[model samples]
Target chain A: MDKRLALILSEVFRLKEKEINIALTKADVGSWDSLKQMDLVLTLEREYNILLTIPDILRMVSVAGIVDVLREKGVALED
Target chain B: MVALVTGGGKGLGLVIAEHLLSNGATVVVVDRDRDALDALPTSVFGKCLDVTQPEEARTVVASVVKEHGRIDVLVNNAGVIYNEPLVNIMKPEGIMHDYGRFREAVTVNLDSVFIMTCAVVEQMVLLRTKGVIVNISSISACGNEGQTAYAAAKAGVNAMTVTWSKELGRCGIRCNAVAPGFIGTESTHQALSVDSIKHILQNTPLGRLGKAQEVAQAVATVIENEFINGVILDVNGGLVI
Candidate 1:
């Protein structure tokens, strides 16, 4: 996982860096509510300097899904 | 802070804009009247656009963002106080209130707020700008007599203010409305007859009409207070009606 992506998720959801994993989904995080989702989307947009569509935003329900969406948007998300 | 005020070319809106400017905000005033827009102070950035049109609102909002980087606050003060009885018993013909005028009042009072808020909020969300929206409502929202359309529109404005505050709070956006009572403004005096003004004064606890600056102060208070959200604050002088 990209260090920046992991750090953003950790900061946005107020979780430990080690807690961020590809297997983690929004349902697993108690703090991943609508507000947190907006924060995540904003943080990701700022970090990647990319605009996300509604579909892309909705598809980012899990870490793996977020990775896939970023990849589809031409974001390498490499370490 | 960059503040955009609609219908800010004259009356109470101008007062609010100037007050915001005095408070160190870069103020942008938009009005439909070119003459009024031109009459604004040089320090204010005046743009002539009808706020009721969604397309025009979007275009103006985009231009404002382009010029000022982002809008930190939006004051939806572009509205007309349309006074018409539901039915005029003395009229010989067409006694009922004109439907066309009612629609126009709604369009100007309620639709402008919705349209401008949509455009500004879209920009704020996309830019991730933490912003405040201050909608200028009126005491008439509580169902003022002889102002069916105006009252209905202001009530709608109050509803939108609450709804947007709940929806946008997560986005770090606050929505609030300042409902002013009868103020000693040119428009207010022009709208109400001498007897009507006397009646209002007698009923008001303060025994006088409100000043525009007081309403401006209320607006500034809501804008400055970070914790305030979805509040339909009344700037009236203890006048319920």
Candidate 2:
């Protein structure tokens, strides 16, 4: 889950692998905005091949929240 | 003088058509919306056109030249937009649920611009007329959320603006673009929330939503100013940094 979340964050925000710390938020990242937020949601859904509702997108505000939503959707982490 | 304005039936296009008519230029409003065309003033020439179809574009241009004798100004103002996030767009859901809207937006906004511009340029060259083309770009060209396809397309428009300027400059023709910010159109006003409006105002030094007339005025200025070529005139009230 951690690795997949990192990959999604890095690609959507165009951040380096090291820049995608778990503590990342809209304030910590300059590129983070409503538009990028939407893009991030889309990228996650595409990457995981899962459907995210508008409610899910609106509720996801942090890295942990994103992981929790993915877990709720039953996306298993690779061991 | 014959002037062709793609998507001239409403909003910015309508304003441009009215402005050109006031300037004594015969205006041709080309759009796919027949009902919208019917609503336009009778003095303006309204043609039902699907500009993405290159052959139709050629036919429309030829018909205009045959009727009007010469071409002078071509304004590519017809465009569409999709506000959904890209992920929801790529899902394998039904057409309406997925990125189908994005495909249409790209076709109408981006592809049509290329087809129409090329068609007009060919006519201008064959007629040996020194012409002007005003491409209606957007603030999104600099990048915006929920507008990946649109931003890419407008960016392409800006690039083509510069490239066409160079290609057509030696032919005594000019090509430029008008990148508009938020305007006070009914649709825009409806789509944006009060906070979104406030945010836009705060970012814009002018502290106001731009008017369609203001954008039309800029387009007119670009058309008249032969010295301004391959330049994108930003009418976004300084919204873009």
Candidate 3:
């Protein structure tokens, strides 16, 4: 879960792997705007081939929440 | 009063050339179609030149300047359109889709604008001539389906307008763009019926198609309004919300 969350965060926010922290939230990253959130959702859908609902997207307000949604969608998260 | 308009042989370019010529500005109509160039009125100095070629642009601008002694306005109006879903786009399947057509569209639509503008601007700056450059952009620039390359290219034009407005502002050259929505041109009317037009109109606030002259009027306003620079005027009747 930590590794997958870090990878997604790094790719979506264009940050280095070392720069991403599991505790990061919307307020923690300046790049986490509404547009970037939409882009993140789209990227996750395309990369994992999982159709996310509006509720799922809205619930993913933090890195841990994104991992929770991915787990709910049956995506295997590497610890 | 010399002015150069690429693709001035037909469509919006033809209307803009006529408007400028009617205002007593000597016009040079550049197009790849010699027949179309010949079809222009005698008042216009027509030349068959493919603007994609940088050398050709320089040569034509020089010829127009030699004959008219000055270039007061330049309108980069030549463009092409394509419709294909981004994912299903064949024939140059790659990162950007339709790589061949994408390359050609970028060259003709975006690069040619840069080539012509640079060529004309060099002369304008050397002669210390204050002039106007109006790039014809599309509402698709905002983001539309089946227009990945076209959108990127037109967006490039919009960005260039802003950058050039600052770079050449000191030289008294104003750069601006016009983003037109779906207008009821001959081609558009043929492609779309009254019912389809109504759909677009329903989406648009004005509830009708736009005339080419309306777009020309917007361009003319940009040209006449000296203070107006780095502006991407929406002549779409508020279609783009």
Candidate 4:
């Protein structure tokens, strides 16, 4: 699950998988603007087969935040 | 490319669909008229549905995506040409335009475009398809006198086209409108009086009605050109100029 999440982030942000980490935040990524944020939200929703709320989307500014939001949405992130 | 054209069963929409098919596109046509859908060519896919309803729009879009895998282009062409002056002094009573009729026109013309676009755009984004949207606006969008509802609806369509072009460009989606002038379609003839058409011809530099094929070609051009976004291409033969 971790690897998949990293892959999605890398693909959406155009970053290397090695560059993605739990510490990575929107500020740390150069391409994590509003547009890419929408892409990320869509990608995660499609990948997890879950609909995200506005608060869930806003809370997902960092990798750890994304994981927390997923968990809150009943997405089991533990490998 | 897989193209979905609403109101493609007859008239200008049918011509547009055929033009796309000739250009090697897989065209799916949806219209509210069942008889018209039944008359479409065997090569084109036809579905009967009212584009104004959100659920029906979503369902048709889903079915098309399920069959063709993705929708590359969506042409919003389903609309009614409503002509009524805001005030008709000739009438004995109710000189003002009927609010119900105005609402009906706006619903069919503008709301249908909104509903269909949302449905197709969702599929395009989810499938990651770089898609194009071509809205069939009218020359009346600039505010013709006897067409309050039609003009307002088409102007709204133009605004939405530009707005979506900016919003969806990052997602590899392009939106544009083709505002055709007095096209020599049956509907155009039915909509205008003989004197009105003559006046239009006198004002237009081309001095003739536009062909349906010409509008279709404009649609094709916008779809094929990768950089033409948020443009309202006028196919009016310099009528408004």
Q: After superposition, how far is residue B37 of candidate 4 from its true place, in Å?
A: 0.5
Q: Candidate 1: which pairs clash? A: none
Candidate 4 ranges with C-alpha deviation above 4 Å = A1-79
User: For model 3, which pairs clash?
Assistant: A1-A78
Off by over 4 Å in 3: A1-79, B89-96, B190-196
Candidate 4 CAPRI level: incorrect
What is the lDDT for B7 in model 3?
Answer: 93
Instruction: Report the lDDT of model 4 for residue A46.
Output: 95
DockQ winner, 1 or 2 = 2
Please give each candidate's TM-score: 0.75, 0.75, 0.72, 0.75
What does the lDDT come to for candidate 4? 0.92
Docking class of 2: incorrect
Candidate by candidate, in order, the iRMS in Å equals 24.8, 7.3, 14.8, 24.0
Quote the lDDT for B66 in model 4: 98
Regions of model 2 farther than 4 Å from truth: A1-79, B88-100
> What does candidate 1's lDDT look like per residue over A1-79, in tens digits?
7888899899998789999999999888866654567678889899888888777777888999999998888898874
